[model samples]
Target: MVSIGEFGSKIKENISRVIVGKEKTIERVLAVLISGGHVLINDVPGVGKTMLARSLAISLGLEFNRLQCTPDLLPGDVTGISILNLKTNEFNFRKGPIFTQILLVDEINRTTPRTQSALLEAMAERQVTVDGRSFQMEKPFFVIATQNPVEFEGTFPLPEAQLDRFSISLTMGYPDEQSERKLLKGISDEHPITSLKPVSGQDELDSVLKQVKEVEIEDSVLQYIISIVNETRSHRDIQLGVSPRGSIALMETARALAGIRGRRFVIPDDVKETACDILSHRIIIKPEARLMRRTNRDVINEIVESLPIPINNEKT
Candidate 1:
């Protein structure tokens, strides 16, 4: 049986064949996946956001589906609709792209709020309701949603409720000169993604997730997580704070991070490292603070720095 760290490393190495110079970003994405959480990639266009999602799905040997969200996209389009089958004389449900193991939602913000709300149930509950009937998604169901951060025209910002559904929100910044050169050369003939093979599958992924849950988290670390969450609620620069769900995500991602590092126990650094990605999108800053140039990331940094790091007595 492959260990969690080995499984993670194999997936990262496979993805890197296509996505260059984003090792840390890939690791964070894997961490979120191991924790059974969805990702929101918020960045400018042409940053390999779609490629990252595709690479991960290919590397994991999962069934991948892409949805190009638009203003005309409807709830039925995403969750599927019941159709009358004249031959059978009854209505039959046709599954949508959401039925797949890995779903890539491209330009998610371009869709209207009603259409955006359609994903909320599927993402949160791993199931969809169509014509008063619910359908459960297959195991290892993961969503990788991307949006352009600088564009607001014809884009409806995701509501806080929907935002909270994503475990981590990240950005894939432009690659450096060396990485870009490598990328250019690599894609000149054929895209590396085409040759990428699955290093792990659903069963191995399930094992890794089980290991992540078993990664020991000390009492102090638990309190540390709570402290940071509490600070978000009372912070003056923020109008809304992270919910208990955010705290849970922080803990789960931290454990996954520890497992990725080949450690059996979580440390303060684990929580601190995953804190920004886990909590940033879930927070809402006040209008005055936004005017003052205070971002949610800035507020989260403040909260993280203000709290004391928990010291673990046992060696990990």
Candidate 2:
């Protein structure tokens, strides 16, 4: 069996064939997948958010599907609908794109609130209900949703409930000049991702996911996580704080990060590294904070920075 770090590296190297730079973002995505969670890629258009999802799906050898969300998109369009079959004189159900293992919801913010709510159940419960019947999703179901900036035209901001369902939110900033030049030079009629192939198999994926649950997290580190979460609730600048789910996500993500780095135990750095990504979207900043130009990321970072690291040399 391959180590988690080796598995992570294999996928990262394979994805790099198409996705240039952004190594940290790729790693975080892998960690989230191992933790059995979804990702929200929030960025301006043309930053390769969709491409990143495609490359990841291809590299993981998972069943892939893409939904181009629009204002006309409906709940049934995402969760599927029951149809009357005249031949059988009964209702038959047709599965939608959400049935796939790796579902890339492109421009998710463009969809209506009713349509967006359709995904909440699936994301949180890994199942969909149609006409009083519930269908369980396939194993390894993961959602990689991409959205344009909420400030962009014709986009609806995802409600906090929807945002909390996502384990982590990431940004694919414009690649550096060197990386861009490399990308430009490498461009061809066929995209680089088309030639990319899976490097890891289902067995490895399952093993790593199982092992992530076993990754040791010390008491001190657990307290550290709680401290950060508790602070969020009382912070004067914030109106709403992260829920218990956020702390759970932080702990699970830290475990995955430890496994990805080839460590059997989690450290403070893992939590610190993933806190902003996992907790930023889970929080709601006050209007006063926004007026002061404090973004969610900024508030999360501030909280993380203020916390004292537990004294431990077990796995630094």
| Each prediction's RMSD to truth | 1.0, 1.2
Candidate 2 achieves a global lDDT of 0.91
Q: What C-alpha lDDT does candidate 1 achieve relative to the native structure?
A: 0.91
- Residue 91, model 2: lDDT of 99
Report the alpha-carbon TM-score of model 2 versus the true structure: 0.97
* Candidate 1 lDDT by residue in tens digits, 1-316: 7777898888888899999999999999999989999999999988889889999998999999999998999988898889999999999999988889889999999999999999999899988988888899988889999998898889999999999999999988999999999988888577788888888888898888788888989999999999999999999988888899999999999999888888888899999988988899998899999999988899999899988898787874
List the candidate 1 regions with Cα displacement exceeding 4 Å. none
Ten contiguous residues with the weakest lDDT in model 1: 185-194
Pairs with steric clashes in candidate 1:
none
TM-score of every candidate relative to the true structure: 0.98, 0.97
Backbone clashes under 3 angstroms, per model: 0, 0
